[model samples]
Target: MRYDLDTRNRALTLLRDGVSNAEVSRRLGIPSGTVAWWLHRDRARNGGLPGAHRSTCHTCHGDPLDRTAYGYLLGLYLGDGHIFQSGKHRVPNLTIACCEDWPGLIDAAEDAVRRVFPHNSPCRVRRVGCTYVKVYSKHLDCHFPQHGPGKKHTRHIQLAPWQREIVDEHPWELIRGLVHSDGCRITNWTTRRGKRYEYPRYFFTNVSDDIRRIYTDALDRVGIAWKETRRGSTPYNISVARRESVQVMDVHVGPKF
Candidate 1:
């Protein structure tokens, strides 16, 4: 095809953006066969298409703080690496230990914020040796009681409002059957016998009886065997004592009966 350099590059940009050759050909009034040839030639010369060659994974030698990649990463995390199914593991809240294990997790998180709001950038990413408990108080937990010593971690993903709305609207249509789970610590300090006291906490989820009943009914209809269970009014309930407390943390609902 004969065209100006700018026009040709524009077409190439479309291809880089994931438009297939057939679609590009139709849009640009070029033959599909010619588009295919150009794609092959571009790949041969530049190693790969623009975004294709650029590692989608932040861990793959790209800047962990790359906003665009991190925004996508946050979505993946919020979806618990997948959507609408049982998660392989529980979600965990932000912590020094978790960050250490993932290496550049903070960078990716910060990048996500920047990518979402390019004009208003804030440096929320930091390398802290201490965790929330250490910096704040031992009794501080985020939302639920599933936190603290001897408790399993709950993974929490920061979802944008729109993303949360989408998930909320299609509670059953989560594509991969899982969403990221995490933990948060909400500190409730106390004073005992004129001395300060701290307590570790944890959380668990209590779905509604209505939802459970519906689930069990669906299972029964599908000939699946499942034990019936009771439900509670609140999704998250907390049981507190002198030394410790526990709260509802995570809940998974799907139609895989």
Candidate 2:
């Protein structure tokens, strides 16, 4: 693997240095065909060129630009070596109309993705639809483990093929957590003039080991007493001691801080 990597890099440098592929291959004692393959694969892996190959040369006939045709091209790209074998994908259900408008949709999605995941590397559009599109990125799938060992965890849906593929490819990215929100009632609600009475209540919609750790750390930091409660038809709630509210700034750090 190291020898191959070194040879491939040397071939790329030669190509970039204006040395002919055939000449490079001959000088390196490697086949010209092999050199060409290496050069193409290297460029594609680095996102310098499209990841897949064309079936036939386009000089003889105009290439098909139709969405249906591009779907196959997109699939080829997705399955190519450019995508890290460790990372998996989320299968998107695309409509014909969306696929037909893929180019424009891709342009829009690129802009949106940059704003949210600015550090994220560029992703090639692997597929598209009226309402959905699949993009190749460093994202991986996360799964919630089953309640107990020896039992399949069907409570949460399993990751789809694309997602599983990515997850398997990049196991380090999997993160588990629970999402929570709070609702409150005013203290003056019971008084005749307390029209806006507030009761502080927060609930957890999902629970995982990670969630328990986070809440535990938070409560410990504030020196506040906390209790978990469950009631009829609602959800799991956490009641926090109201003796004193912790300063928000002390709880969160800003870049400048």
Candidate 3:
């Protein structure tokens, strides 16, 4: 199986910290052989290589971007992520607020940031209700060109052609990320003729129409049937209620963990 790039990087980090290959494998739920190979590759490549830095960013180093990780990160970005330029150096910090209810998503969001900015270690800050997974780098714009001033809903947000290509190639990863960020799987039930019936569906809610379009466009590419719905005052809810579509989602992007 092809493991996520973030998982590989994580294993390397733990190995460098002097953790044994067995411990790293146990902690990361990766194979012992895989962890050992990562450590071996790191030492072999650079004779005790130093940590990664922003200079290694694909935009600067001319390395191919980790498209699989980026595909998922794109969904998280459009759903509830933000970029803020702070501090005197004006380093942009990409922050994605993940609800505490889904601890799995919190970990997933942090992993995406780490893999995208491989050398940098992201930090998480806990708010009253959600945890903010944040990373600082100047090259964030190169990765997420949709970042700009003003609210996302008030401004126009569009993906670059290259980004669309990635989404096309890894449609399910994008959908999984988006659903994990802003969407949920829910069930509605009723009783009719002395029988109980339940309907399970998936809903993605966002204030930005363009962002919603991005989500739906990906769904179209994956052949998942969806329809527009409303939530309270916002008319930006997309629902996938068809039984067949739910089956596809169950196989690929089930409920948040």
Candidate 4:
């Protein structure tokens, strides 16, 4: 005897409202065994009880997040992270690509994900040149409303007011995450006064103009001066080259160890 969706929902509602399985079955004229089975199935899908999964999602739990960690994760997401929906259940997994050469950064990325997401363990997948740190939860969309179809560059990425507040409060963390994902520190040398000199600079390159703006906005918040440039005809790159600015970057968003 297959029950309609409405019947299942009604039975669930009755059970959630403190009606015993047998009593719900009697009221709805459903078999006691069938009603019990339906409740069990719901529990399995919903992490053992109604709203149990909410405890893992800060937005759903209505609790304050570890916003500093979340802000850094946001930068990583806007830089090299992606979200893919899992199954028909609509839980989305967040994956951030980290270069294989930087083991410390890989560890930091995983640690940050754990700090922001309660009880959810992030996994790492190694690829040709990079490793991906991934964690799955039902409420990723609530955290990252910027997610949508198509490439990120094709979509408009703006932070919500709450997220902007987090970025503003912890601008360096965001900048560090962004630079770790899509930026690097390099040394440019030239012969000056018959001597070789090295100019160490930091550059962040991303294809999305909106993401570029977000990165630069964070830089501005931290009093780091930057210049935007195009290498050839493609790629928007932000450079921190001035002595004062480079010192700031070195202190906060230093080279990946």
Candidate 5:
């Protein structure tokens, strides 16, 4: 039921632009009551009531670094990261769960968190077989506009203008992040005309159509070609099996390690 600052701001903006609360709620997937409450609160604050003030966070300010860090974080978030408000105080926490087998990925995620929020420290939580890199910050939601309730596939996913700018500028970093989280590089062996051959390729799998489109769009931006592979049902896979396509992916995404 907790809404991020970005969501609240977006809802308020839409309302100011003459959008109905029900329409905004339907579009943003926010409850109608929440929208009404926000509008009422805004009106009260504008009325100059005592102790009625707008909340401000780091996002109200500008980003410290360029979009590289944010692009990487966004990819990771779309793949395996999650954000939620917890505790009695309702503090927002961002957690990126990476497989323990990939220590390098864990390290990379931690490094990105540090670079994105130098003031906040990230912690690691060890589950049964996965390690979660977690950070507590209100501003985390600002960087990831795609954060919302339920599974990503069931919800709408769209990149904001700033996010698009980042991905456009550094598609490789975005690809690296997505590949490290949801994709893998492997060597495939096959027999062709009584000959055994080995080839290297990359595979990406996700259930969210929007997320899959984002990944494919990034690949297209980098001039890498990928094709859809039938993977049973639900989750879909994108494979880069062609030699030239594999080469392009290798140059940008490389191996997760």
Candidate 6:
């Protein structure tokens, strides 16, 4: 029953903000006893209530942004993430839906969010077939400007200069995140002249033209070649089937679990 640092910090913050223990528990979906225990422990350590006195603590704030972290988050956001504001709250919620089939990607997404916002606690909720990483933070909007009213392709999607710099510096990492969330690496077998041969390739499918373009642009920065194709009339596909390109992608992205 050991909660992580982010969870403990979030519970404390909610209590400090005058939220009842039950409310905090409900919001975070943790046991009420755990919330009460954490608050009691904090009060015992401090001479007064948990939030009664403020002190200088660096750990009480968010972590500084890094290229790899930002790039990964951006790629995930572009792929399976969405930003929405609840009817009752003004602050926006950033939710990334990860398939339960790939627990590693879900863990990676959770870890990336924790690294970027060390002080804020991201909650994980289980659905029928997928898990969602949800965070309520205004700072999320600053990082992902792609948030809008309509779908990604219907709206404008552009990268800020700083974001561009990060993508330029760490294209491989960005590509890894993008492919991990929306693309897959698989072995394709074909029979030619009664002989069967297998080759490894990568494919990324998305409905957002802009997002696909950003993905391809990142690949281009890394000198990896990709081709664009369409499945029917809606979803666009980007395939990297060349031996050299596949090798490059394998080195960076590997296989998602």
C-alpha-based local distance difference test score of model 3: 0.87
Kindly report which residue pairs in candidate 6 clash with one another. Answer: none
Candidate 4 displacement at residue 244 in angstroms:
1.6
lDDT of 5: 0.85
Task: Give me the runs in candidate 5 sitting further than 4 Å from their true place.
Answer: 1-58, 232-235
Backbone clash numbers for all candidates listed? 47, 18, 0, 0, 0, 0
Candidates in descending TM-score order: 4, 3, 5, 6, 2, 1
Candidates in order have lDDT scores of 0.38, 0.37, 0.87, 0.88, 0.85, 0.84
* Tens digit of per-residue lDDT, candidate 5, span 1-257: 78889999999999889899999999999989999999888878685456544333346765465468767877888999999886664668888999999899999999988877776779999999999999887666777878889888899999988788788998888888888889999999999999999999899888889999999999888778788877665559988898998987777678876
Clashes of 4: 0
- Please, what are the lDDT tens digits per residue for candidate 1 over residues 116-157? 333333333244651111111111132112233432223322
Models 1 onward score TM values of 0.23, 0.36, 0.77, 0.80, 0.75, 0.75
Q: Model 2: residues >4 Å from true position, as ranges? A: 1-13, 20-38, 45-188, 191-210, 232-235, 241-243, 246-257
**Looking at candidate 2, what is the lDDT of residue 166?**
40
Residue 62, model 5: lDDT of 57
- Name the best candidate (by TM-score): 4
Query: At residue 8, what lDDT does model 6 achieve?
Result: 93
Q: List, residue by residue over 1-257, the lDDT tens digit for candidate 2.
A: 23477777888899878899889988998888888888877778766675443222122334322222222222222211122232343432111112333355344434433432233344554443333322333221111111223212213333345434443332211211111111121232243565654533223222333333334444455354556666675335554435343222123211110
- What C-alpha lDDT does candidate 4 achieve relative to the native structure? 0.88
C-alpha lDDT (0 to 100) for residue 245 of candidate 1? 14
Question: Which segments of model 4 are wrong by more than 4 Å?
Answer: 1-52, 86-90, 233-235
The 10 consecutive residues of candidate 3 with the worst lDDT sum are 47-56
lDDT top scorer: 4
